[model samples]
Target: MSRQQLAKLDQLSTGQTLKFNYRQNGVPREGFLVRLKDTWVAYENRCRHIAISLDSDNGEFFTQDGKYLFCQTHGAVYEPDTGLCVHGPCKGANLFSIPLEIGESGVWIDME
Candidate 1:
């Protein structure tokens, strides 16, 4: 696997997300990294139900309570760490997780 840095650890506060853009075979894609409790989690930013972006252009991915990732378009809720859709239309599905590695310097994605 090849590693690419996404963001520095200090760049995100707990419960906040950092959106990242990447190219796959020259096609553009978006991903996001979030700090959850003691670990960081990454997802493809696409909603499981409609395959649309979970957040708007403003990067609003969390619900009002800030405990779950919210899809404003379809009202789907996901577990931040596990990416499991615990509520809404996509209850049985999960967000596509991106393999990530965290180091002292930054958060990195395994591009394979």
Candidate 2:
């Protein structure tokens, strides 16, 4: 596994989600990072239920209320911190989490 630098902590604000690209088996894939309170959380952009991106448009993961990650595709609502699907088609499912590291310089992810 190799770690890839994601973004500077100062670049993200509370409740903000940023999209990132990483390579898997030499194929580029999408992931995302979200700032919740003072912590950073990350996950693959795909939805567990339908294998589709959580966002319908760029950087639109959170619901209108800004409380949960909402998938417009199938109405899946997820807990941003844990990636747990709380409601919608795939209840009891979860988003695929990507391991992340926070350093003094920036955020990093295990891209392997």
Candidate 3:
């Protein structure tokens, strides 16, 4: 399987996020990785309510309180660890989760 590095595990602190691009089946896709308090999470940037980015290019994924993921365009709130949309238009839906592999070198996502 092919993989791409997203961020250095040492560099990403708790509550920080990094955005990266990758290709799946030759189609470019956007993804974001967040270093949550106790673990790491990654997801496709697209909001379930609409095929738009969760953040309005501002790179802000968490709510001001840092308790949940916030979609600027759709107001969809997602539970960071589970990707479950607990509130807003996409309620009952989930964010597309990208399995992440955290290693000493960095955070990686399988590209295959």
Candidate 4:
């Protein structure tokens, strides 16, 4: 797998999300890095309901309790573990996942 150096894990805080580009299926795709439970997870940022960005003003993408990722645009809630929308408009919709792996070097996006 080809890995790309995107951003430092320390640069992100719990409940924060950042967008970046990575190669998938031999094509560049946009994805998001979300900090949760002291771990970072990467997923496609597009909301399945309307195919829009999940983050709203100031990149605020989490719920008030910071338990789940919430889409302010359409009120869709997603599970941080699998990027699956558990409630709201797209009940069965799930965020496309990007390959991610953490190691001694740091978090990395697998572009294989």
Candidate 5:
């Protein structure tokens, strides 16, 4: 596995997201890091129902209520902390989770 910094600790407040990219085993991939409450979570940007991106890089990942991660293209709703698709076509599936490392300096994603 490898570690790569995504953002500084203060760069994101609660309920905010930051988009990032990484290469795993020589394959390029897109991911996003979100700060929820005081915890940070991440997942691959790809939707479970389809290969399309969750937000198309528009950077809007939450529903109007800000209660869950939302896929604008397909109305998929995911639990922010677990990456579980709790609604929509992808129900019962989950966004590909990316492990994270948080520190005083920044946030990092562990890629394999």
Candidate 6:
């Protein structure tokens, strides 16, 4: 795995999201880091159904009620626990996983 330092965990806050790019197979791919329940979860931003970004124009990718991550492109609802597309067109689909670990310093993107 290629090494890409996204950001420090303390730099993020609950309900916030940040975008980062990593080189995979020599191609730069974008992903997202979301702060949820005082922890960070990372996943490829592309939706499984149409390969479109889940976030809207402003990078806001959550439901109005802030319960789940909603894909604006096709209205897919993903469960944060597993990055599984639990509702909408891509039901049973799952987002690409990016392993992450947390510590006293911050969260780190596991590139292993």
- Ordered from best to worst TM-score, the candidate numbers read 3, 5, 2, 1, 6, 4
List where candidate 5 sits over 4 angstroms from the true fold: none
Off by over 4 Å in 3: none
Q: How does each model score on lDDT?
A: 0.87, 0.88, 0.89, 0.79, 0.89, 0.79
Instruction: State each model's C-alpha RMSD to the native.
Output: 1.6, 1.3, 1.1, 2.1, 1.3, 1.9
lDDT (Cα) of model 2: 0.88
Per-candidate TM vs. native?
0.91, 0.92, 0.94, 0.82, 0.93, 0.86
| Runs in model 1 lying further than 4 Å from the true structure | 24-26
Question: Compared to the true structure, candidate 1 yields what TM-score?
Answer: 0.91
Q: Which ten residues in a row have the lowest lDDT in candidate 4?
A: 52-61
Per-residue C-alpha lDDT of model 4 across residues 1-112, encoded as one tens digit per residue: 6778656767777777787887777876678888777677888777888977787535677788888887889899999978889999998777887767777676787676
Q: If both were scored by lDDT, which would come out higher, candidate 1 or candidate 6?
A: 1
- Report the lDDT tens digits of candidate 2 across residue range 56-93: 65779999999999888989999989999999999899
Q: Can you write out model 6's per-residue Cα lDDT over 1-112, one digit (the tens) per residue?
A: 5455676767877888888776556667778888887578888888898987788546887788888887987799998767898899999989887777676667667453
Q: Give the TM-score of candidate 6.
A: 0.86
Which one wins by TM-score: 4 or 5? 5
Over 4 Å off, model 4: 56-58
Give candidate 2 regions above 4 Å deviation.
Answer: none
Q: List the residue pairs that clash in candidate 3.
A: none
In the range 1-112, model 3's lDDT, one tens digit per residue, is 6988888878789989989887777789998999987789999999999899999999999999999998998689999999999999989999989888887888888886
**What shift in Å separates residue 96 of candidate 3 from its native position after superposition?**
0.4
Identify the superior model by TM-score, candidate 1 or candidate 6.
1
lDDT of 5 by residue, 8-99 (tens): 88888899998899877779999999998968998889999989999977999998999999898979999999999999998999899888
